[model samples]
Each structure stands twice: as structure tokens, then as C-alpha cells.
Target: MIKTSLVLFFALLGLNLFAQERPTEDPAITYANTITVEDLTRHLTVLADDEMEGRETGQPGQYKAARYLEEIIKGYGLPGVGPEQTYSQPISFISERWQEIDFVINGSSKRHLWDYYAYPSKNADRAKVMTDEVVFLGYGIESEEYDDYGNQKLEGKTILIMDGEPKDRDGVSYVSGTEEASVWSEDISLKLKAARRHGVETVLILDPNFQRNLSSARKISLDSRMHMGFSEKPADNYSNSIYISSETAKTILGSSYGKVVKARKRIEKKGKPKSVSISVDLALTQQKKVKELLGENMLAYVEGSDPVLKDELLIVTAHYDHIGRRGNSIFNGADDNGSGTSTVLEIAQAFTLAKEAGVGPRRSVLFMLVSGEEKGLLGSEFYVNHPLFPLESTIANINVDMVGRVDEKHAADPNYIYVIGSDRLSTSLHEINEAANEKYTQLALDYTYNAEDDPNRYYYRSDHYNFAERGIPAVFYFNGTHADYHQDTDTVDKINFEKMARIGKLVFYTAWELANRDERIKVDVGVKP
Candidate 1:
């Protein structure tokens, strides 16, 4: 019995010593330390060069960028997801460029690109020609208090409506919010969907605001818009939408304009919907040049060491796309995303090096360079919807956008970074980030842009929003907007490489903690800070 007790005590002592001396150094930290400013500059030089042509979505520039990323990741010995044995995740896109538009009201030809403007809708094919009876629905709003189409038969009919919702006598909007317009007024998509639900085949939004300002029409003409959903074709019974001048509405109503205006005022004063029928014929003809294109999101991963935890994933993303070019000017988006992209490359390499050194993290990390982010987060949205890994297994996302330069807010204090959505879904995630920063790359981790009500809406603007929307914890690293943001002046010379490397290291450290932690970060649904 004495000999057995002595053996047990010795074994316990050995176990304690083993626990205390367990390498004392985190290999993930060692890997993160490998990320360097020189490597970041080297990658950025190639990515943001003028020859790359701004890395526009679905364009040659973006394709080249995708291929470059794929080759780099492949070189790092990272394996792709499927049988393709490549890092490219192809996404299909349909591009629409409007050529011409003709809108006629009551046999009187309306001016094109002046009195009314029609954009190439995903709902329209190569051409869309519609001749239908017009109905004037005041504001075209349907609410519990008042229904505009309560007893109205609007099937296959074109409805003309105002831009804003109703207001009380005091001029305060009745829907919600005091300073800004309600959701109904803010989102035209909501109004369009509502109009379609009421069996309205077409909608003409008459706004005095858009009439004089030809900016919207100019933008639509300048850029070819891409859409992912094909069901938007008008031939598929989708609603046709157009924005017209108030003058067009007046011309359509003619002698009944006074009565319509009176009804509008009455509705605004009474805080109710006033639906009216006007005898008018409306005709719309649009011509579009269509092109189908393919885009790709570059995805590469480092597998975890622990067999059980290898299935869990953490994603690091940056959009490698920007507006291609406008005439002679190239909007070289070096700081916009090239910085973030290069940083991702370095972080990925660091992890790869660590894995080769036989000290990989416990959970997997996916390095994604998504395209179509400039085109409304298309690639990220597609990934979330058709994810290679189950979203439930996605532990968190660290998104980097425009982290190279110091913005106006941080010009004096250049070491600061706009950290958004850290506490949005996970309290533990935020704590990990704070601790990582305190220990490693001591960045001024700014949370000013993290607020949901922030005007810039940084949280919703980046690729991380797609992950967050799917209940995954996401944090966006940003350097706020500068004068050169989305402009031709945003070139490589303007990028602050040292500051960028620091931010990159911060992200790597945060990811290191997340990937090496014993358990997944606990999601804090209530804390949105």
C-alpha cells in the first residue's frame, strides 16, 4: 500500500510539472509574428498597380486579381475545398447596360433622360415594351391604418406614386422617426415589392427630388449593373419600375392634377392613405445591352490540428474589387482594399508556415478574397447562401476594408483603426480582440463606426455583414473614408504600409486566439456594441 501511494504521488507530481512546462509559448503567436510590412508592400504593389485596372468585379482586372490570389494560396500549400484542386469559387453574374428608354403618357411623348429615367432592370430582358392603363395611388402605401389598394384591382396596371409617405399637419412623418424619413420613404425596394404584391405590374415613382438631379441616370448610364437573381425578368411576371419627374405625373393627370394634389394634401394632413383612380394611358419602352459574366471568390484554408475541432471554421475576408475605370482615370483602390487583401495574404502565409512547422491552430481558418463587394457584396452574399462549410460551423469572421491610410478622423492619431461589430454577436469575441490588442499589436481599436445607427453604416457595408446576417460573429476593420476614397486619386503612394502591417498583426493575433481557444466564443445577441 505504501509503495502504491508513493507511485501515485510521483505520477501526480510528474503531471503537474508537465502542465507547468508545456512549451510556455503559443505557436499561433509565433506564426502571427512572422507577418511583416515588407511582405505586405510587395503584395500590394502587384495588386494595386495601374496594370491591374482597379480590380473591378467580373472584369479582366478582378479576374487577374483572383488568379493571383489563387496562385499564391496554392503556392502556400493550402488545399481547396472541392475536386477542382484550386482556390477559385466561381460566381455567375448577369450584367445589364441600358441603351435607350422612351416613356409616353396619354399620347404625349415624355422626354427621355430628362422628364423621366428608366434603368436597365434585372426584371427586363434585352427590351421591355409596356402599354397599360395608369392608376394614381397616393404614396402607394399600404398599412394597417390605411390601405391604398383595399378594393382596387391593380393587376397588370401601371401605378404612379409619390416618393415619400404621408405626414401629419405638423409636417412630421406619421410612419416613424422624427429627423429622417420612415422605412417606407427610405427604401424604394420596399415600396416596389409592396406594389408588386398588390398585383401592380409596373410602378412609376414621381419625385421632384430626382427630376432636376440627373446624377442617378448618369450613374446608371456610366456603369453596367450586375444581378445574381435571374427571376427579375419582366417576362417572368416581375414588376417593372421607373422613376419619373413630378412634371410627368402632372402631365399624365392633366385636368385632374388639382384634385390629385388636393388628395395628397388631405392624406398628409389626416395621416391616412388616399387612393384615387385617374384616366390615363402610360407606355414604356426600354432597350438594354445584356452580357453574362463570371466572377470568382478566392478561398484558401489552414486545417486545424485537433480532429474534433477541425470542422469549426473562422473566416478572414477582404474584397479584392473596385470600380474599374472611368475614361482616362483608373481608380486604383490601393488603400480601399488592396491593403486589406495584401494583409490577408501575409496572414494566410504566416498560418501556412506555422502549419509546416507542425504547430497549427485547433480550429480551421478560411482566407477568402471575395469579388463583387464593390457591386453590393455579391460574392460574400453568394458564399453565405451557398457556403462550402455549414454556416453553423462558422465560428467568426474578421473582415478588413480600407485599412491602409489614415482617415480625416485619425490623421493626428494615425495608429487608430475603426473596429466595427466586435461585440455585435459575441462578447467573448470582443474580449479576445481587446486582449489580443493589449498583448500584441497595440492598435487604438476605435469603435466609433460600430454603432448600428452610424451614418456610414460600416457594419453593414463590408463583406462581414453577410456572415453577421447569418448569425456568425463578425468584426470589420476599417480606416474610415478619406478624400481619395472611391476616387482616382486613391493610389499606392497614399498607402501607409507601416500602419497597415500593425493592423494586420492585430487581426492575426485576434484570429490566433480565436482559432487556438478551447471552445467557440459565446455569442452575445443582446450586446450590439
Candidate 2:
């Protein structure tokens, strides 16, 4: 009787649906089609396995993670978007490390050498400066409205200055009437670039943080890698970069007297050049030769259905590389981004399932697992600069980084996932996300990282910033930081698979809405700092 009732209920319901002639727009169907926790868990189990050796970037573990992602993408019956049968991108960077750096001031000509301490330049070649006079460039910034150059030009000169952008007259980061987030348009790097435009040889930052981290800077340089291209030639060169203590700097500038100090003070005061009173020679000692290593950024695209809108795409990105190995233990990164990478794989699967169910999206999707994110957003930086697809035609990007752990601040409720950059560049993208959540999983969506001073630097830390830099609407999902954030203990067992699945589902729903929407989100809302 139970079997008969079940069959009869289904038959009657089918007849009623046929009578209603209901379209396929039913919410019930979409919800039923979503992937389950078990499905997502199996994938995570394999990717986050202990044998993978923590999946460090540039290591065998990172290669293992890459192969796993490729195999899964292929198993889903989707064609490859990369060249021929490969999904890997090779990338490298020219890195440097300093050792035994010392200098003296007060014209005593005394030199001091410290262990792996000095300023390291990102220049492609080695430079040496033995006793070059350091010019105080103030903020080293230049703009049309207010030039920080102090009406002076910088060419073939090494500069010294403060770390960040200059504040307004009120000592705040922004102008009083310019809005709270106006600082984005005022990047100090832009000022440095201006100096670079005048052929500046090297940049020497003298911020307190740089002063304290001289040893790390040298170590990072010594332990650096060349991102792309190779060179067999030695790195010996004519110019070199180094740092002097504030006391030494004062003495050295005392030769120029009032000019250098006055310029630095003015640069700090209003971020404008007050003018230079003297010139100092830059002497560099060629240190070492630079070699090239290889690495790459990965990109793939899912062709869209609609002819008119196929050119417009939605981007889904995450970084696959971690800090590589540290001593004996591997940084498995099960959470830092192993979590985000796993979620991307699952999302690709979910979308494939949707396609099989004839619910494929109207617009195209590009699923990218970038490299070198932990290395100062290098991979995404390259992609944005040399995209596989046109940037302007790309509508938006949704980035996933470190989504495995429930933030300790919000550990009491494990269902939360941090969302950042939702409304910064595009209000419509933000709206689509909000509406989709209300209609889908209904999990608690958190945006604690959205605050300007939240300090985690989530906005500027990940691949999404690359897209945001080009004025593309972007959203980055994070699960906050933990005790093991950059440590080797961010292992697989710590992952909350169930919560991870829910977060993936949320991302899926949001992407689905964006993919099928008739119009792409607009970026007229503008970005904040």
C-alpha cells in the first residue's frame, strides 16, 4: 500500500503539473539540483590528503594540487581551455637577498656590516652604490594638481622617503571633503612611479617598518625567485641599493644641510615637495648576478550560450600557490587557499552538473586558479596585464581565498563566510549577490573584513585586487584568519568540510545568478581605498 501510494502521488502530481503547464522556472528544481556535502567532501579529502605534502607552491606538492585540479576538470566531461592538453602556467620572479651591508655618516667614512641587512631592489639587474649621496625626495610623489616633486626632476637618482601616502593638512589619509575612501586614488606607489618616469635608479624606503625589517628584506631578496625568463649571466652591475640609519642619514644630509631635512619634513607634512638645497653622489658596489626561474598563471574559460552575450564573461578566480616549503614541514595550506582551490574545483563540477541538467548559464565563465598570490599578487598581476580575454568585456570577478576555517572572532557561529568588495566597484553585483543569498542557502553572510581598518588587508591581499585595479567589479570570500594562518599547521584535518560545502554553495548560487543575468553589473559605483 505504501508503494502504491507513492506511485499514485507521483502520477497525480505529474498530471497536475501537466495541467498547469508550469515553466521550468521553479525554485524547487534549482535547489534540488545543488551539490551535496558528501559530494564536496570527497573532493576535499583527496586534495587535502597528507600525502600531498601541504601543497606548497613551486614544490612537488603544488604540482600535485595542479594535477588534481586538471584531472577533476577533465573527468567532468568539460573540454580544456588551455593550450592543447595542459592546464599549467609557468611563472617566475627575479628576487634578491642582501648580506653584510653597512655604511657610515658624519663623514667619518665608517662602514658597518650586518647579517642579511639592507634595502633590496626589485630591479631586473644587480646595482652597486658605494658612497652615493642619498637625496631626500620627500614623498617622492608627483601629480598634476599638486606636485610632490617640489619643482625638481629625478633622473638616474636613488631616493629616500617615508613609507605611505602623505596625509591631508589635518594629518588624515584623506581630504576632509573628498570622502572617506578617497585614498585609493592616492597610491604612494604612483608617486614612486612618477620618480621612475624620470629614470630613478633605485628606491630606498625609510619607514619605521622598513627600518625594523631590514634583515627580513635581505633574507627575502636572498631567498627570492625569478618569475619568468632566465639568465645565465652573472648579476654584477654598476648600481646598488642600501640603507643607512636615521642618524647616519642625518649626518649625510647635514652635508647638504638644511635642504634634505627641509624636503623630507615638507614631504611628511603635506606630501608636497618643499625643494632640494643640495646634491649627493650615489655610489653603488655591484653585488651579485641575477638568474631567471619559471612559473605561470593558469586560466580557462567556459564558452557561453547566447551569441550576443557570450563575449561578456564572469570571472571566478583563486590562487593555487602557497609560500612553498619551510624547513622540514610543508605548508599544506589546507586553509590559506587549499580551501579556496577546493571550492573552485567543486564549483566547476556544480556548473557542469547544471549544464547536464540543461540549466547552463547564458554568459561565459572563466575559472582561474592563479599562481604566486602569496608572492605579492604576482600571478594575478600578470593576468590582468596580459589577460586571456579582454578585460573591459569581462563583467566581474569573484575571488576565493582562505575559506576553510571559521574565524575565531565568529567561531561561535560556524556558518559565516567573510565577503569583501561587494559594493565597492559595482552596486549591481552586490545586489545580485544579496538577492541570490536570500533565495538560496540562506547561510549567515558576514562582511567583517569590509572595514577599511580591519587590518587583515583582505581587499589588497588577494587576486581580486587585480580585477578591481582595472575597474572590474569583484568579490572576495574569506573565512577570517586563525592561529595557523601563515604557519605550517594549517592542515587538512582542521578543515570544516560541511561549512566549506555551504560556502561553496553560496558562491555557486551567486555565480549562477550572475551568469544567467541578462546584463552585466556596472562599475560606476567606483572603488574605495
Candidate 3:
């Protein structure tokens, strides 16, 4: 009996020592592991399915997707942060489409898409303007270096101007004094501002690349566009402007067309302003249809355990919208954002599970699955403009977009993600992400798209940009674009589930550190809006 008792005691002692030596598993890692490939695949399969109708904002498929997400988050026991404690924040906007536009010069009607192109103006549903004489403003540029308006009385006058600024012999712009185009050339709105300043009622812009511009503009003009319904009407905004081809300008300018071209050349050489008056009979008419539409941004939150820190929020975002159906074909958008939405769902579940188990983060975390991302980041834009929580209290945003498939750059090595705008706002946030990836995911944190000069301009392309613009630190995780991006071919079967789960784990681990940390991540950098 003594021998048996001694043996049992020694064996128990060995087990206790082994337990002491082995470090306790971190609850963060424990919960992060729950974001498995199976869960990601399962969530993505439903979101990217054809029945969801591509999840276009304000459409039936989008509502279905929103309901599915609401159900999932509600099932996880997370509270809704939206109005009336509902999972949805209702967003109302105006959808406008141009129906018919007529331009007549000297009683001869011009073609709409061939001779000119114009977008629906918020000013009026229908407009008619008649002018017997049109002012010719060379380049329509107003600046200290060169002024096109030069003491001209343009009040209620119709003006015709050429597109782009004058470039010198060495191909340097006279306005910017560089090879790069200035705001006058880059943003047509600036030129319109110049026209509006002069009290011009109608502005005709002559495009050198009219055919190419019209072709591209035609694609978008065929589709209806949405804007905030409460915003200013078109009449309250800038003057009515129309883009016209050289042929249209020739009809309007008559003999003055050659004189206007010579004026542009003279200005390019002498760096001076030239203005002329052209006598032409013109009448313009535009008709548009505006419809009010409603969309939703699905929001749910896990309140922090600590009282003081719970007030400060961390946001995790993903856009659940895609380009809707085209005829019978559907743009499933599995990799474009279905992957991102699923990752967010899984992350939300993991956080909820952690909270239920009494290991929640110290800072509140809000999970936002937004719509209209494919529509122009409208959902996120609306959220930042009309936030449920104080924008000042929001600490950081972590956005996941397009994290499913391998791009051509990573075909040989698929274990990588593009991290954008992390170091843009906070060095601390960027370091935290790097540390999380190093310790847990170990996936290649590629910053290929993070460069300020990156031609892709991806930093400003996604939903995270809305938060970043509001001085909030943000990080965007992406798997990069594939051949199937934004196409109907972006189906669920092409997703790299293992890679997606790893990215989700990395996001969770990063969020874990950010939320539980004693101090909020400092914004050491300035935001350029």
C-alpha cells in the first residue's frame, strides 16, 4: 500500500510541474483560432451565392444579405448599434438618371452622345436656356499666373471654353509651371468654380479627347447614380456645364473657332490671358428623372468590459455590396468583397464568443458591414457624416476588402496580403499590425499598394478611406485584385479559404491588441482629406 501511494504522489507531482512550465494559452489566440477556414468558407458561400443577387445596395439581394448578417450577429448575441437598437442604419439617397438632353445651335439639333454628353444636374429636373451670343473664354482658367476671365462681365452669359490648361513648348503647364497638370486641368469643378465666380449661367467645355471621354462617360451615364437626398439641388450648386466635341464647338464658334485655337497657342507662348466674343444662336434643354432610394448599413457592437474604455470605440468594417445582376448574369463578387464580409462575420463571432466567455476586449468594438461600397463608398461616407457614436471617440478602423484569391504577383507565393494606409495615420497602429502578423499569422505583409505615389490610388479607393479622412487611424487588408475582380466570374469556388482565415486571424489578433491595450493607439500622422 505504501509503495502504491508513493508512486501515485510522484506521478501527480510530475503532472503539476508540467502544467506550471507550460504557459497558459492566450484567450485571444484561443478565440482567434475559432475563425477557421470552414467558418469562412461557409459564410462566403452564402454571401456569394446567386440568390443574393450580387448584394447591390438598395436592391432585394442587398436586403437579403443584410438580413443574413443581422441574423448571424444577433445569434452571436451582439447588440445593434444602429437606430432603435436595430441592426440597420437606414440611409436615404437620390437616384438620378438623365432621360433626354437636347442641344440646338442655329436651329439645328445636335446628337446627344455623339456631339456632347451631360450628367443629370441636381439643380432642376428640366431646364431650358437660350442665348444669341456665347462668350469664348480661353481655357476658362482663373489664376494669379493666368486669368481667362480678365475683367469680362460674364454675369448670366453663356461661355464656351476648351478643356485642359495651356502647355508650353517644353510640355510644362503654364498654370502649374510643371509637367504635371494643376487642379484647373485635373478637376473640372475648379474651372466650374471659376465660371460660377464670374456669375456665368451656362458653360460649354470643348474636349480634345471627346470621343474617348464620351465612350467612358457613356458607360457610366447609362447607369443611374445615387446621392444624398438632403443635399443641395442642382440650381443651388454651380452653373450648368456641358462637355462638347470639337465638332459641336465648331458649330457654336463658327469662324471664331480658329481664333480661339490661336488664342490658346498665343497664351501657351506668352503666358497671357485671351478672351473673345462669339456670336452664335444656342438653346439647351435637359430632362432627368430622380427617384428616392433607401439603403442600409448593418452595424453591431460588443461593448468593452472596462467602464472608462468602453466609450472609446474601434471599428471593423467590410463592404457587403457588389455590382448587381446584368440581364441574367450575376457579378457574385466573392473575392471583391464577399470574402471581406465573411471574414468580418467570423471575426464578430469570435469576439462575441470571447465576450461570452468573460474574456472580451477592454475597448468597445463595432462591426460594420456596409452597402454601396461598389456604388462609390456611399455607405461608409454616410456613416462618417452621420455617426451613431461620437466620431471623436472612435479610435481606429480595420477594414477588410478583397481577401480571397491570389493575384498574378503572388501566383508563385500565395501567402501574402496587401496592407494599405496603416502607417498613413499612426505609426503605432502600423507597428501593432506588423507585430500581430509576425507573432501569429506570419503572412507576408506586403505594402505594395501603400505608397503615396502608387498609381492604383488604392489607399483612397476602399471603405476604410472614409474613416481615415475623419482623422481616424485605419488599416486596409486585401488579397489584391484578381482577373475575376468586379466580374461575374468572381464565384465562391475560386476563394483561397485557408489564406482568408489566416488574414481574419491576423485582423482579430491586431484588434485584440488594439482594444485591450491600456492606451489607445496614438495618431502621430496627419490625415489628408
- In model 2, which regions exceed 4 Å deviation? 1-33, 82-85, 95-288, 291-293
Model 1 per-residue lDDT tens digits across residues 389-430: 889999999999989999887788898888899999988889
Residue-pair clashes per prediction, in order, are 2, 37, 3
What would the TM-score be for candidate 2 when compared with the true structure? 0.61
lDDT of each structure?
Answer: 0.82, 0.68, 0.87
Worst 10 residues of 1 by lDDT: 229-238
Q: TM-scores of all models?
A: 0.62, 0.61, 0.63
lDDT of 2 by residue, 373-448 (tens): 8868877887777677789889999999988888778878897888899888888888887887788667777887
Question: lDDT per residue, candidate 3, 218-294, as tens digits?
Answer: 76567675667553365656677889988788888898878878887788898888877899999998777777666
The alpha-carbon deviation from the true structure for residue 411 of candidate 3, after best TM-score superposition, in angstroms, is 1.3
Best by TM-score: 3
Judged by lDDT against the true structure, how good is candidate 3? 0.87
* Candidate 1 error regions (>4 Å): 1-24, 95-293, 527-529
